[model samples]
Target: MQPDDLVLLTGRDHQRVTVAAQEVGLLPGTRARVEGRVLDVTDTDAVVGLADDLSTRYGGADVVISNAVARLLPEESQAERADEFIDVSNTATHTILRAFGPVLRPGGRLLVVASSLGTLGHLDPRLHHLFDGASLDQVEYAVESWRGAIHHRTAQEAGWPVWLNVPSKVAQVAAVRAVAAERRAHDLAASTLIASVCPGMVDTATSRPWFSDYSQAQTPAQAAEAVLDLVFTEHVDPALYGELVRFGKALDWHDGTPPGEQDTMVTP
Candidate 1:
């Protein structure tokens, strides 16, 4: 990647991102050459428009980061608003990939912000069937199925948060893996690397209001740095291309262990 490559940051709030960009030394005049755009990933038209605009203006993106996320509020999960959870977690990610995947150039990188909860072994038993032996099509079905279940529930049961939080992440990572396989089989000439990463309890304004404690959480800058390390580093291991990374390390999802357990595992 060029030192002055354009880094497009999109979100619902471009102003806040502008401030963030400045703090990260990614302003208009800076060496990072960053620009911010207001985008609602949930809106299909908006997402398509952004991709078209990017393709027209710059040919394609060298790096695409699908980091737009929505967290469940403590009270909201108690109600029948599971649709919101599904939209934020699963649907939004699906939309982003569909719209932007074509616009990613050869030798580019695609990184989605997944979570530790996404690991199949780490998921709650109640939702294990959703992921067990699931193909990408099955994962998508699971997300829609959960949304429908929440809508039809007769009681004010509070299972939305756990279901939405982890399952959505599971789907995200699974999508990354599936896409990597497809890319390898069909677009081998591109040599693009696509994967997801868990930022590990980032202590941001978006998270602080929901998480009970900020202790041990990484700052936004710190988390971004870890991702950038993976993004910019040359000669990445082929095993990491389709895996879920954390703290600049890749985890083996099939190891039958939670992500935390695999964190200290030497790759010998």
Candidate 2:
């Protein structure tokens, strides 16, 4: 692993990750070269450029972390923008994989920050659509495609490890669990590690202020530390590569657990 690794942060989540990296003496432009390239993960230009840049610089990345969320609500809540949560998540994830697939070095790491909402249902009644009439089989198929694309792209060149972290509600865990099971059954090339880190109610600037009312709400720093612990650890599994890591309650990555238990595999 390169001492000076290249880190890419897309969208608002970058702010939190940036602070965490800085605390670890890995700030961009200081410890590692940090590039604030603002591009819509769903945009073709941005995705393509990301791939090109990653391939060119560092030959491939030691780690690629994505915290990009799809546009859920409309610019004007009253305006008519499609509330297609599935489409946004699938498209953004697919675009990132397709574009940057070729640039992840073998054994290199890719961490995708997904909400637990993707797995567990009923956390928010409004998101019931994710589970309504939803089949785990179909969800598995989508996840396989994602893992396959990344694996096939880097196979001959330099295969890398792909990890996914889906931390949200019960609904999110269900989604991640189904996907991990499917990946294992299919036996995809590149390893797909999945974990769910349920942070309960995260009191971030982006989240509703009312979230603070929750006694269990966690700070952004706390969450970021949990994520970092998972990303840096070894003992990754290929069979159960995908695991859902819950964050709140008693479970946490930063609290010093067993070696492998601390790492939550994910797909990004």
Candidate 3:
């Protein structure tokens, strides 16, 4: 179908992303028209208000892509940044799903942007420490619950398709830096999550800067197209929900052991 698709952008104000999208003809009335910007995905009241507005205006949407991320800090500064990240990134995601879930149509798609940081460690030493006491099983369980609740409420039928785009560490870092370089903090956390859930970096308004790196990256428009393809062509089974879709290439760690290799047994 022609890109007359209705897309809701949560936190995209950076010039690079906007310019790239426009250059690639993804702007409204082009490939896809972005109907709204949540402005403040971190604010519960704002998120609810935006959701209500979208429901009233469009009634529902074919796709809802959330690209938000939390602020990063040094390990010594993590104790303070942790709560902030959770509130802005994790908690805000839950809030958006809760608010918009009921309005989404059946068979419609919901894409949650997550980071490879949420999956593989070792890429960033800071993340290794951040996830020190974390449990992937528990984290995955929570994500499933959130997805289930949102999909259940949004779709007309019992099953609503939800997918996650989880990109690797380099891609995630590049995405964050893209926005940070532009000083766009509104949806930084959300954007990070969006980059995370997708299979690879997208070539859209948000990802152009990363592509400029040449050494490691994909275009945001490419990423956007991939996301659309996944929503329309992929057969998503709710039972198979919560899969982390990586972007670009997977990270290669020479010295570090691969995931699931660490011994779970506690040392005496």
Best candidate (score: TM-score): 1
Q: Count clashing pairs, candidate 1.
A: 0
Q: Where does candidate 1 stray beyond 4 Å?
A: 1-4, 21-29, 124-135, 154-163, 185-190, 209-213, 254-268
lDDT of 1 at 65: 84
Off by over 4 Å in 3: 1-5, 12-32, 36-38, 73-76, 119-214, 237-240, 247-268
- Judged by lDDT, which candidate is best? 1
* TM-score, cand. 1 vs. native: 0.80
| Local accuracy of candidate 3 as per-residue lDDT tens digits, 5-79 | 555444545554555445545534466654434266768888888778777887865566766755442222333
RMSD from true fold, candidate 2: 12.7
lDDT of 1 by residue, 6-86 (tens): 776667887887776666564444666666777788888898888888899989777788887665555554335557656
lDDT of 2: 0.45
lDDT of 2 by residue, 79-177 (tens): 122223333455555455445545656544445556543443222233234433444544435344434544456411221112222212232344544
The residue pairs in collision within model 1 are none
Ranking by lDDT: 1, 2, 3
Candidate 3 or 2, higher lDDT: 2
